[model samples]
Every structure is written in structure tokens, then in C-alpha cells.
Target: MTNPYTTAPMPPQPPLRPAPKWARKRYVLPALALAFFIGIGAGGASGDDAKTTAAKPKSASPRPTVTVTTTAEAREPEPAPTVTATKTVKVTATPAPDTGTVADDDSGADVYYANCSEAHAAGAAPVHRGEPGYASHLDRDNDGVGCDS
Candidate 1:
């Protein structure tokens, strides 16, 4: 009896077919993008055409012509006017007196703080020049405000 392991020869395998060439996304994406841009351009051109067609004049009319004429006459020259009289003038100015006190709308000039930290602690972080607890040291830029930081 033939051996159980021995089997009929397997039919020859069919030849493998080559894979179909696929369009790469790198090329296809750019082509699609170019097509989209061209479509948009075409749409814009068509829209402009529609507007121009709608705005076109129904009939053409001849433009009117203008004619200009000029005439000149001879005339005598006029005499120059003479000056009647002249006078001299003098002016004087005086310096105004200096005022020691500053005029401020807010009345907190007496309040003083040693530093920005002290002012911040006292709930007065930003102090203007005329406001209370404002000092030159607290304002680094000297913009008339203190404890700005």
C-alpha cells in the first residue's frame, strides 16, 4: 500500500500578478490643490464677466464736442500808491511771582511711604505725583507716578 504521507503532487502555483501602480498622494494632493485654485480663479473670472455683462450699456451715444474762443484788449498801466506816514512802538514785560504750593484735585499730599513695598502693604501700590504716598524713589522712570511696579 502507498504511504499515507505520500500525497499526489500539488498543482503548479499560478504566476503572481504584478501590483497595479497607484497614484502617489504627494503628486495627487498637489494636482488636486492646483485644480482647486484654478477652479476658484475660473469662478472669480466668471463672476467678473457676469457683473460686466450686467453693467454694460444698452446703447452707445456720441460724445458732445466743445469749442473755446478768447479775445484780448490793450489797457493802460495804473500808478503806484505812496506811503503817507510811519510810527515807532515800544513794549514791556514783567515776570510773574512763584507759588510754593502745588494745585492738585486729590487731597492726599501729606501721606508718605518709604518705599514701594510699604505703599503696596498699605494698599496704595500705584501712587501718582500729586497723590498721597508718592515719592521719586518709588518711581524709577520718574513719570510722576510711584510704586508702579
Candidate 2:
């Protein structure tokens, strides 16, 4: 029996070499050439060729213009003038005071309305001596009360 799969020996690679200076010279020459041309063009001076003359001040008129005047005849004196002055006065009115009834010293009335009005109206509580339902509710000394408390 013959072997169908067989391999041959490979050849060895060459050693690595260092880069030569001339390898970069190709790129450097073009850059230097561009910079030299740019310097030469930028260094040249440019100016306008047209010649300019100095501006002169304008001359004034030989003589100044003057206005003319005319005179009138004088007249005789007349009678002295009379003046009369009149003065006016202004008046303002004050408003009338209110005569309506005012609820002063309203402690008892306010207390009755706020705490006892509902109970009294519903008839749930009698107007007793110390209870809010009673007219005598504020009697702190309790002699069968009224605002005396």
C-alpha cells in the first residue's frame, strides 16, 4: 500500500533590513519645495500703481452778505390803560353720618349663636342655667344664670 498524503520542506525567510535615509528623502523634497515656493510668493511686496494728490481746502466768499433796515415816523402818547381783576371761590360738602343700629359688646350674642343656636332650635336641650341652650348658660356663679357670670 502507497501513502497518498505527503508534505515537502518549506524554504527559510530572509533577514529584516534597516530603513535607508533616502527612503524618507522622496517625501521631504516635495514638502520643502512647496515651502520654498510659498515663502518666495509671500515675501514679494504689492502696491497700487495709481498716484493720489493731496486734497485742498475750499475758498470762502470775498465779502459777507448784510441785511437792510427801514425806519418809521414816531407817534404821540395816548391815555393810560386800566386793568380790572376778578377772584372766584370754591366750596366742598361733607357726607352725613350713619344712624343705623350697631351691635356693640356682642360677646353673649356671638356665644349663643355659635354654640347653642342649633341645640335650642332642635329642642334637644333646654335653655338651662349652665348649658349653651339656656339664656342663663353664662352664669358662672350659678344663681340660675344670665350674663352675670
* Candidate with maximal lDDT: 1
Measured against the true structure, the TM-scores of the candidates, in listed sequence, are: 0.28, 0.20
The lDDT values for all models are 0.71, 0.51
lDDT of 1 at 47: 69
Number of residue pairs clashing in candidate 1, backbone atoms closer than 3 angstroms, sequence gap of 3 or more or interchain:
0
Clashes by residue pair, model 2: 127-134
| Candidate 2 Cα errors over 4 Å, as ranges | 1-7, 39-45, 49-149
lDDT of 2 at 82: 81
lDDT of 2 by residue, 6-56 (tens): 565557889898778898897899999999999988865444322222244
Q: How well does model 1 score by local distance difference test? A: 0.71
List the lowest-lDDT window of 10 residues for candidate 2: 87-96
Off by over 4 Å in 1: 1-107
TM-score for model 1? 0.28
